[model samples]
Target: MKKQSIKKTPAKTPVHGSKPALARQVRIIGGEWKRTPLAVLDSEGLRPTPDRVRETVFNWLGHLLDGNWHGVHCLDLFAGTGALGFEAASRGAAQVTMIEHNTPAVRQLEATKTKLNADQVQIQRSDASTWLAKTGAGTARFNLIFLDPPYHQNWLGKVVPLCQGLLADGGLLYVESEFALTDSADSVLPEWMTGWQVLRADKAGMVFYHLLKRQ
Candidate 1:
């Protein structure tokens, strides 16, 4: 027994990928993540809603929700990191369909979805503008639709019109952009969405949130 001693084996350590996980501390400004530091993905040009803007938007729309999230569907277009949609789900939006085109952004979205356990959220990796145009005609039926496209691309013109078809009766759509809707752009909103009023327009830092009502 003294001649041969048992060998102790070292435990295996798990290794992560080449790069560490990227996360943003997103405090709920409105909806369910309110005041909570939600984990969000980060990529170049993928801007998550700032705290102040989220707070303002939520403050404006807080009354509309009225605890009616038990049966509602939401669509988040140009969903860079899927933060908005997830926030909706966390707040009780029945379902969420997230659309993001960028490869890196899409990957981050998938990662975030897993971390948040948001199985109710569906992801579609495609050009939101083209995808909506092809299948969004007269489809307005979602309880909530959000569009946060990249600046300089001018995606609002194409996406906003398409959203009218997907919004459910009296549903709300939030458009996040860098372009301010000056008097010049007022008429730019299509006549089709005449019912969708500009509920609130708030600017925080460089980001802007334009809340619309699918009247």
Candidate 2:
């Protein structure tokens, strides 16, 4: 008896020639861009701030500024997905400068800016530390600054001090970290963080987020 021959199925090739993984998206939680979804790239250590956390942060800021964003200038030092920066721009920030070192992330930011017709938003591809150092003091000042650098890098220690000079008087600094900058008696405030006073703080899962002001 002849053994039955096994048939091999041909592998199916993707129609799009190796399509990249579908980008994850996060939405703008408030302002004119409310509920607008922006694509998020899967870069190493890139964690977009959570929606609930962002809502709480913006709420705190709104209360502090009495819901006025007309003259606000915002700096997003580590703009992973432009979530924070775009949100500020949507809320009527006069200018929003988003710094992202990742090439893909920067391109995505530009695309989103164009899609939104965001003339007030500027995207810069540069290392956050390098940008901070080169920008220096008094050259530019922002009413709000978002610092959500990659975790475990001690980025807060490096850039927090520089932010002081770049921040306008009465400006607010928003930070997201793996560890709490405040509320830990065991944690000594780093010299760079000493000048900042935590205005509002809360934890969401592994993230410790805070809104601070210069002392």
Candidate 3:
């Protein structure tokens, strides 16, 4: 019997209705790893910065970073998804330490570090306030600090002073909260936050983001 030859055809692309499901990931908006997606975990108060907000915050720090974050130390107090720290590392930060006490979130952050092979990034499974209290300014001072703790839990009040003390001269601090801190005179800042001043502020939905600088 003679054998017959069969032709091969390429697989058809799935239609819109059969599109692949989107991954639960947040992307790096700028720097070398732009658009690299980091997985998001199921954890309480794990809100990653929205792309627009992240872009705005980086743009505000453009002059400070001067296109490179080399030699800069950064701290993400409530890392959650490691978005802020990873973004800082991608932009050339010398060291980016992220602190998250939640078990699942810490695992997620570790997974991201492994996936990115981010030598500059460090994930610490510790409470934000506890870490701040233990680390004195002499021990570790950061050029940029991210204070996006779980909203409405008074975490800011607990860590603001510690973070301020840990900021180097002319260091920048980025804060995100549930309500606008600029809404009223009393809402501006606590009495001890005298050396810090808001450089930029904006609102996206209920979130109020601020970029502050230490004198």
Candidate 4:
């Protein structure tokens, strides 16, 4: 089968629908779902992880992360519209727990969860920080965890450690940041990266992608 490309459209972008005035497609980025479209959220500026970024993140993850979809349990922090989690589900992940706080985004996520007919996904409408801390203890217990917060919040530092307890040994963590790597350890390293490989740091324009392995 031919592989489909990931496409990005602004949130609340209008499209046509038979049921009413118009509808939008959330659009899946990988697996049999590549190029698949769902509805758009009426939320403000919900960017849905750009296709290039998503593709690159997953590309590196395939090499660095241990699990290839199946048997893997994922945690998607800031899971806007359920993109990363749903993509993982489509790629064969056994389970995905998604956390998002925005009501419109959450509503869209819930809608997507139902529309995809996805059974492997668990959706939660909760604050990213609270959920990560509440979910796990300090053992590094997840196969994958995604962290992509709103750029203005400068939240990466505080939230990363909260997620550490949930990451399993040899687990992989992918962080999408709007800022470049700062000089201080306090600025970037997730408390969970205490013994993990720094792996790689790739930056493009305003976006920074860090790949870390939980040792």
Candidate 5:
């Protein structure tokens, strides 16, 4: 489906050190926390996946999830709003770890966790690339991973291979980028993706979402 744009009045700029206006909320579409609202902080480059895009991604994952999503472990590497991680936890993922370097984002994640009493989710304030490099698959492999880093930073180039290493056998990785993967000059795939294969790909407005699996 072609994504539609929602028109809204421009937000007023906040003064330095002043409290920023409340950003819009992102709602979980399924599982225990279905319809629950998560605050999206007004951080620079903060873009939560669009509702239609997330709905499509989860639909692609539905069959694999089974009934309770038992024994599933997930990682949200960029974790701007903890949306993916929290949604996985709500669906009964054994554990969901969210990693974000932004302090306010981390605080909001903690607040959401506390609000939902989500014991199965862990929030870490750290650079996603550094953390992925430091952590080994043997000690911390995840069955599902979400990668939605700031666009145009070459972050995907650095993190995709690390996520591939961190994924267990048959694991899945979901990525969101500003350009479609088919456009090579615009979106470059890493050379180390020998074990990686695209499972699904779709475009939502200007954003491209992909689901991959490690073979």
Candidate 6:
């Protein structure tokens, strides 16, 4: 009798229309929502600022503001997971407007806002660039602006200049980029970065986070 042959089954692949999994959760490291966890969506290029980085950044801000977040108006250009914006709100920022173009991400932001009962938070569903362009200078100015757009898209070049007009004098701008903004021979500062001074900067893995103030 001939031996029977067996067939092997191929591994199952993710269905095309299935929803993406929740990537992970990041907690508010300080303020009213301290230790509160926010859900992060598994979207391409979505990088939530790590907890350690945020703690350092906020420490820098706290020192600058003398530990006062009152009356601070913040704009999160690429609000991704609402980590930065919400953090600002948690710290008592007067207002926090979060810009997110992705639908699911926007939904999550709304849900988080509702959960926190954060009346100071505002969720806007629009592309950051378009929103900035439509928002006239002097009409709105934030004491702190968070610019953590997706990396390597020249988003800094496009939005940094616009942020100049939206940033109040003596305000702070927190940025996360793929590379350090430097004037060294190997790495030169982009033209848009002119007129800004890097007050504090540190690196975590491949992230080059900086806190800047306009000259």
Best by TM-score: 6
Question: What is the TM-score of each predicted model, taking all chains together?
Answer: 0.75, 0.88, 0.84, 0.76, 0.84, 0.89
Backbone clashes for every candidate come to 6, 0, 0, 9, 0, 0
Give the Å shift of residue 188 in candidate 5: 6.8
- Where model 4 places Cα greater than 4 Å from the true spot, the runs are 1-26, 38-45, 65-67, 136-140, 182-196
Q: Weakest 10 consecutive residues, lDDT, candidate 6?
A: 14-23
Question: Once model 3 is optimally superposed onto the true structure by TM-score, how far is the C-alpha of residue 73 displaced, in angstroms?
Answer: 0.8
**Model 6 per-residue lDDT tens digits across residues 11-120:** 89867886876559999999999999999888987899999999999999999999889989999999999999999999999999999999999999999999999999
Cα misplacement distance, residue 25 of candidate 3 (Å): 2.2
lDDT of 1 by residue, 35-64 (tens): 556555555667787767766665665667
TM-score of 4: 0.76
lDDT of 5 by residue, 1-215 (tens): 99999999899887788687766988897899999988888789899987778888888888755554779999999999988888888888899999999999899999999999999998999998678767864668889999999999989888887787788888899989877654376556567555677889999789989888977
TM-score (C-alpha) between model 2 and the true structure: 0.88
lDDT of each: 0.74, 0.91, 0.84, 0.74, 0.85, 0.93
Error of 4 at 136 (Å): 4.1
Per-residue lDDT of model 3, residues 28-103, tens digit only: 9988889998887756778899888898888888776787688799999899888888988888889999999999
Error of 5 at 174 (Å): 0.6
| TM-score of model number 6 | 0.89
